[model samples]
Target chain A: MIHIRRDVCGYCGACVSVCPRGALELIDAYLTVDETLCKSKCKICSTVCPLGAIELEEQ
Target chain B: MKEAYDVLVVGGGPGGALAAKAAAEQGLSVLLVEKRPAIGAPVRCAEGIGKEALAEFIEPDPKWIAADLDKAVLIGPDGTKFTIGNNHSGGKVGYVLDRKVFDRELVWQAAEAGAEIQVHARASAPIMIDGKVSGAVIHQHGKTYEVRAKVVIAADGVESKFAKWAGINTTVPLTELETCAQYIVNDIDIDERANLFYISYTDAPWGYIWVFPKGHRCANVGIGIAGTKSGEGHRAKDYLDRFVAREFPNGKITELIVGGVSVCKPLECTVADNLIIVGDAARLSDPITGGGIYNAMYTGKLAGEVAAAALKKGDTSKMALMVYDTTWREGPLGHALARNYAVKESFIKMDDAKFNSIIHSMSDLSLDEITVKSLVIAIFKANPWLALELPRLLMTL
Candidate 1:
């Protein structure tokens, strides 16, 4: 699962744009990730987040 | 129960607020809606604006200003620094704004002028009747409501969909869109003034790195790259991260802002029967600087005034609203944006050596002699080969 730190996310929607799978959406000024659509082993969101808000968990 | 408004302004940024204020001041019932929980939260801008441009809207209040900039330093690709004093009238002098305070204040001003404001209201789509926009469907707190208005001012930002829903073409080519990433960093060593560093075709291809100072040793450091150069292996964040690590190694980033800016010419049509688009949705941002705050508010005021006039005449037809487009394009703002777009196109094609030479030539000229005409002359004088493209460039202005 990918973890999103709501406390730090600025909700600028950068991750949503860069997500190749269209798995992220900004809902009510918060970044909401759709796990089913998120590509496994994809680090693009975590890498591109300016606040480092998105983190990947170890299986 | 639902009520109809004279004008419904969407997206409560500077443009939306100003439009609402202008309409309400004319005694027209106006409503301004913002999707955010609070206005100006989750800032997506570099927050810099020219003093003169801002003066045309409202007097500067200390409550919204972060730093008053007196100079702008430009760094060439070869690491040569050229400093320009902000002494020129109607240009150069600027301020880094606290957008949270600034945006909220604009909305407050609109409310004070008698415009109703609603936060957490998201405009889902336009309500069209017989191919004409009559109002919009808004979603708030998991409930949907249809709001009717005689005129709808689309002040939505870059990712705007209202214009498209209204049957207006708002497609932007990838080449004209800028992918941007920024960080609000603290404990950084920077001059009190702002600086724009350009390293053409490298590090930030077709874009530049900006460091806008905020007081208390804090600054907004950011990078923007041409959209065409940003995918498949190149990322704007990678470039921004590298620059931040090298320049502000000891700095702590407090916030991250990511967004896109359209740097194309204004859309062919910004108005269509009872609907007008202002601000970024209208693609009013400067092509070279990616600055839209000043233009957004300027055009927003015009749209509001025009919409009011159309209402007074009891005509909200597309023909009546065409005046807004004409006034904006023929005004100083339009001329400036068009000219800057030309400069941006030409500047993006130059190699590092060409950029260095141009900067070298500019370094010798006094700021007073650095007008657009003179700058063109300087470029031609530095590298005569560019003279062939002068006519095409001049025509854009």
Candidate 2:
């Protein structure tokens, strides 16, 4: 699962654009991730996030 | 509900605001919509604008100015630095604006000109009528409304899909796009002036890094990299983080901005029947510097004027709106953008060694002789081997 540090997120949507699974959406300036659709092992969004807001947790 | 307007503008950035203002000033009922709750939150720019260019639009309001910069320092890959004082005529002098205030002011100006302003309103797609843009379907406050207009102005920024929705090809090649990441850092030691650091293909890839000082102990530190070089394992934020660590170790980041800049030439066609695209949607930003405020205002004003005239003339066809394209491309702003794009293409191909040599050669010339032609001449004089490439580069200019 991915953890989003809401305090650090700038809500710029850079992560949302790079998400391969379309699991991220920015609604009303808040970034929401759909865990159901998000690829568990993939860390593309976490890597591309400028502020290091998105983190992947160990299973 | 107000379901109709003379000109419907999508996006509330400077471009859209100015377009709405201009159209409204001509007695056209205009409505400008912005997706954000506020006009300029989450600023995605480095906030630098050329002094002379900005002067043409409005006087510098202290309310929106972070710093009045009069010099630019260029640092080469080898730590060689050349400083250019903005006191010289024709040199670049500019200001780092408080974009939050600046953008809102423009929107306020639009409202003052009689244009209705709507925040939190996102345009989903163009309202098409027989293959022509009639207006747009907007989603705002959990409800959708079909708004009709005589003309539509798409001033939406880099991620604009309105142009595509209207059947214009706004696709930018990856090589021509620059992915950017910026941080507004506080508690950093910086000169009152700004610095542009060029590091060949290592630190920033094709694009460069900018440290624009805003005020005391605060600045905008950012990096832009060619999109083609920024996928897979590498990203612009990675480069930016490394640069920030190396330069401002104690700096605390107050804001983070990530966005894409289209560094290609302006679209050959910026108009369709009942539709005109301006700003980033039209790719009117400078290809070399990634600065779009002035260009956006210029094109937006022109689009507004042309749209108003077309409405008055009772013809909103593609042929009628083409006057906007012709006038923009033929003006000084268009010519400068085109020239800058050519210079950028030639500059990107030069390696670090070539860039160092060019900077060394440029140091010998006076500020007056630092024109585009002189720079090319200096390059040729330093490396006579590049004579073959010089012609091709010059042809682009």
Candidate 3:
């Protein structure tokens, strides 16, 4: 699963653009991840976050 | 909102604003929607642009100008400083913009030209008909509207979803992406008229820190690292905080902005059936400087002009809108982007020693403006041996 630290997320939508599965969405300043579509091992979003807001949690 | 319009523009950044302005000036019914409640609040940019490039779009205004820069200072990884002043940089350098006010000014101009403007309006999905984008479903202040248009322009900045929703692949490669963090720091002692850039692999790997004066005792202190180098402990903010602590310990941070910049090539094709993509959405940001304000405005104007022409002819197909794609690719903007991307590719691979040597060699040399040709010539002059290894890169430019 993907864990997003709301406090750290800048809501810049960097993660949404790089998500291969289109699992992330940035509605205004709020960023939401559809976990059903998120792949925990991918970690692509976590890697691209400027603030290190997104993290991968082992299921 | 009207059920239909001659043009629909999504994301009210410079690109969308310019597009809306151009199309509406042509007597087309234009509608521009911005997702944010305000036009340019929470600016996600370093707000620096070449003066000449900006003049091509709008006249220089003191209302939005933060600082008029006549010089640029570059610090090597070893802290050796190289200055490029008016003599080396050409008399007109650039300006550090107050993007918050600047963006609103642009949108206001679009409104003046008869483009219907809507803020706090989000386009949730592309209204597709037979795989062709006709318009979008917009949610504005708790109300939804299925707006249709003869042509749709996607000007959504980075984190572009409009084009992706329309079946265009707009994903930026992780390696080519730049994760960035910035703070508007006040009460810092700074050279108010010069833009300073700090390059350090130890501090910011494959990226650099910038101090662009926002006038007086304030500046936008920022850092960007290659996305591949970003992680838990070494995030862009981590490097920026470290730099700020050492350089401006007493500086007060007033605002923090974090975003991603795509330092990759422009999208494969910036147009599809009934749709056109512009600005950061088209990946037109410079690969070397990571600057996009000029590129966005330039391409946005072109998108609007092309869309207006296509709409007049009653052919808004992929073929008709292809002119927008071709015109930009064949222009000076295209040439600059190509050359800069090549330089970025070469520079990203260099070690700190190479950077130190290059800066050391050019510390006293008088160069003719900042361009790929001039930079390559400088490198050749400093190290004749490097010429043998640069031919392949030169060929691309």
lDDT digits (tens) for residues B254-277 of candidate 1: 987887787889999899999999
lDDT of 1 by residue, A1-59 (tens): 78999886667665554455656666657778788888647666665554556778877
On DockQ, the candidate that comes out on top is 3
Q: In model 1, what are the clashing residue pairs, if there are any?
A: none
- lDDT at residue A10 of model 2 (Cα atoms): 74
List runs of model 2 lying over 4 Å from the truth: A1-59, B86-92, B368-387
Query: Candidate 3 on B1-397: residue-level lDDT in tens?
Result: 8999999999899999999999999999999999989999778999999888999999999999999888888899999987776554544888999999999999999999999999999999999999999999999989999999989999999989899989889988888888999999999999998899997788889888999999999999999899889888888998999999999999999999988889999999999999999999999999989999999999998989999999889899999999999889988988888888988887787788988988888887865465546666676788765667777675764
Best by TM-score: 3
* Candidate 2: tens digits of C-alpha lDDT, residues A1-59: 89988997777665554454656765557778888989757666665555567788887
Instruction: Give DockQ per model, in order.
Output: 0.18, 0.19, 0.81
Worst 10 residues of 3 chain B by lDDT: B366-375
